[model samples]
Target: MNFSYELIEKYKETKGYTQDKQVISDFEEFNSGNMSKIKKGTRHLTANQCIEMANAVGMDQKEALLKLAIEKSKSKEEGKIWSDIVKKISAACIAGILAAASLTGQVVTPHLRYRR
Candidate 1:
C-alpha cells in the first residue's frame, strides 16, 4: 500500500518515465514537497488523487489503485487487514450486482459492465 513503492514500481514499469520528476510531471497536483511527503508516508492522497495516479500510471482499475493508497495509510498488519476488507468489499459488490441482475432476469458480466 505504500504509495512511494507503487509509484516507484510504476515508474519502472512505464517506458521513458525514468525519473521522479517525470512522474511528478504526469501528476496534476503533486509537487516536489508533496512527493517527498508521499514517499516518507507522512502525507496521504485523497480518493480523487488516487484515481488520478491510476490514470497517470495507465492502470485500468481504480479499485486496486485506491487499495494502494489505503495501504499506505496503515501499519503492516493494518495494511493486511485493509486488504482483506477490500477483498470482501469487492466480492460483495460483485455478488450484489449479480443478484440484482438475476432478480431482474438479466445476465451480466461484471467485467463487461466496467470496460476501461
Candidate 2:
C-alpha cells in the first residue's frame, strides 16, 4: 500500500533504517519480502501493523487505519466510499485545528482558564 510505503519512508528517516530488510526486522509480524514489495504497491501491511507503524511514525492512528481500509477494500466502489470518508475526516481535523488556532488561546476572555 502507498500509505505503508510512506510510513516506511518516515521510519527510515526517523529511525535510520537503511534498507527494506532492516525496517521489516524492526517490526514484528511483517514479512521482509513484503517490505520490498510495498514499494511496488503489491503488498499490504496488516491492520495491527498499520497501527504499529502509525505509532512508530507519530501519525494519527485513526487516519492511518482508515487509509489502510481504503487500500484493503475489495472493490473500487468500496474503496471510493472509504476514500471519501477518510477525506472528510481529514478535512474535519484540519478545520478543527484551524478553528482552535484562530483565536482560542490568543485572546484572553473574562472566563478564567484552569491549566494550573
Candidate 3:
C-alpha cells in the first residue's frame, strides 16, 4: 500500500475525521465529493496532493511525507536513477568486501608473524 494512503487513513481514524465533509473542510484544496471517494478507496491521491493533505492536517513529520511523495512521484527515469544508485552502492560494497578479504589473506600464520 502507498505510505501516504496509510498515513492519511491512520490520521483520519485516530483524529475522528471520518466524515467526508469534515475532511473536505479541513483540506479545502480538494473537492468535497472526492474526499469520500478517496476514503472509500474509489479514488487515490497523487504524491503532491497527499503532501498537501498532510500539511492541512497539521502533521509535523513533513520529512516523512516528503520522502513518500518523492517515492510516489518517481517517473520511469527517476526509477532508473534509483536503480543505478542501488547498483553503484552494491558494487562499492562488493569491492570493499573483496579488498578486506585480500588483506586478510595476506596475514601470516601465528608462527610466521611476530606478536607484540
RMSD to the hidden true structure, all candidates:
8.7, 6.8, 9.4
How much is the lDDT of residue 29 in candidate 3? Answer: 63
Q: List where candidate 2 sits over 4 angstroms from the true fold.
A: 94-116
Candidate with more favorable, higher TM-score: 1 or 2? 2
Please tell me which model should have the higher lDDT, number 1 or number 3: 1
Tens-digit lDDT string for candidate 3 (1-63)? 555556667657756887556555655466756655655655666556666656656665444
Question: CA lDDT of 24 in candidate 1?
Answer: 69
Q: What C-alpha lDDT do the candidate models reach, one value each? A: 0.68, 0.81, 0.61
How do these models rank on lDDT, best leading? 2, 1, 3
At residue 31, what lDDT does model 1 achieve?
Answer: 82
Worst 10 residues of 3 by lDDT: 61-70
Clashing pairs in 3: none
Tens digits of per-residue lDDT for model 1, 1-116: 46655755575466466667876676678688887777777776656666655666776555756476565645778777777887898899999999999999797656556668
Which stretches of model 3 miss by more than 4 angstroms?
Answer: 36-62, 74-116
Backbone collision count in every prediction?
A: 0, 0, 0
